[model samples]
Target: MIDFKVLSDYAATFTHSENDLLRQMEEKAAEIYIPIMQPSAMAFLQQLIRWRSARKILELGTAIGYSSIRMALAAGNDTTIVSVERDEAMIEEATQNIEALNLQERIQIVAGDATDDLSEVASAAPYDLILIDAAKVQYEHLFEKCSGLLADQGIIVTDNVFFHGLVCDIDAVQKKQLHRLVKKVDAFNHFLSEREDFDTIFLTVGDGMAVSTKRSCAEGER
Candidate 1:
């Protein structure tokens, strides 16, 4: 396996720098030890948004509004993002961040357990894109819920599928006590990849991202 730290640094050299505000936000997140998406993952998401022209997005985790803001900015001003965060502190911070960015109208932070709050998110159904970055152990459940909420051509992007590389190396000490979580993530990856109704691609970028696009009936038949 490649040293992702080095690869991420090398990729940063080719990507544009974050704006001062975003940079500051990232610095704050790091200071507080909040796990936010890596720069490479953010870049990939921006490009994906542009490519898909996604207008309605649902984010399972709103960690200080980093990915949510990035997606809204990339999808244009009219896009709407419903982000769920179970942590009250994160919800408050994310709401403030979105409001400070003047994106309050574009992003809504829902505070509650994802499993319980997802039903509310589904009310805005047929989301063009769904991003999952919350609890690694609950990924399969989230994916199952997303299937009914996603648009026909919608895409689901799941982060941390690699689980710090433990999913690929179950015996690795990195997953010592969390072996069960690693196993579940690995199984979820297999489930997503083998799903007949979705075309999935697992990328090595940013701790592994599983991008799955639901297959239409016609496309699945062929």
Candidate 2:
């Protein structure tokens, strides 16, 4: 079943010591009013990257570089993460944070609208792991791009499919843009499940995630 919810409050007293660098960045994100990937979500992603021994990773959103850095730390040596962000403000801040961590060589920060021109950015045919967490309305297109760029047994993980529980109750969020985006996300969630080429599992973590892996050639290309 698709579910969303994480244990513990994001801002707790002693949990600040898990990763000092990460904690510092999260605090800074808060100070600057930047949204970040949830801790539970981060942990899940890190575990996946470790298991896959992912060398090449792609991220659609790089807000303050929290997730990208955490993934880098999780994978240790020789891991490359390319994160894309459209906002100049976030890019400037994320650049500073990444440089401060001395991860310039390991991580390549791409500045552009993720939906617009990713095809020209990286010529690599396949990435081992792809993480999606950005504009909700663009996920359908992102999924198409991700599917084209994924390698054998590659996995796709999307965050915020639950959309703060707004997917089920569109009226909860009256903002025109957000409400429409919620509808698109809901449709994508449904589409992922119906695809015979993938086996999707939705785990209960921060904001909900849809984890989809392409069926092997044995599955006969559903």
Cα lDDT listed for each candidate: 0.86, 0.80
Candidate 1 TM-score, C-alpha based: 0.93
Candidate 1 lowest-lDDT run of ten: 12-21
Which tens-of-lDDT digit does each residue in 95-170 have in candidate 1?
Answer: 8888888999999888777777456687888899999999988999989988889999799999988877777678
Question: Which segments of candidate 2 are over 4 A away from where they belong?
Answer: 1-18, 171-175
Q: Backbone collision count in every prediction?
A: 0, 0
Q: What does the lDDT read for residue 111 in candidate 2?
A: 85
Q: What is the C-alpha lDDT profile of model 2 across 69-136, one tens digit per residue?
A: 88888888798788999999889988988888898887888889988767544675478888998888
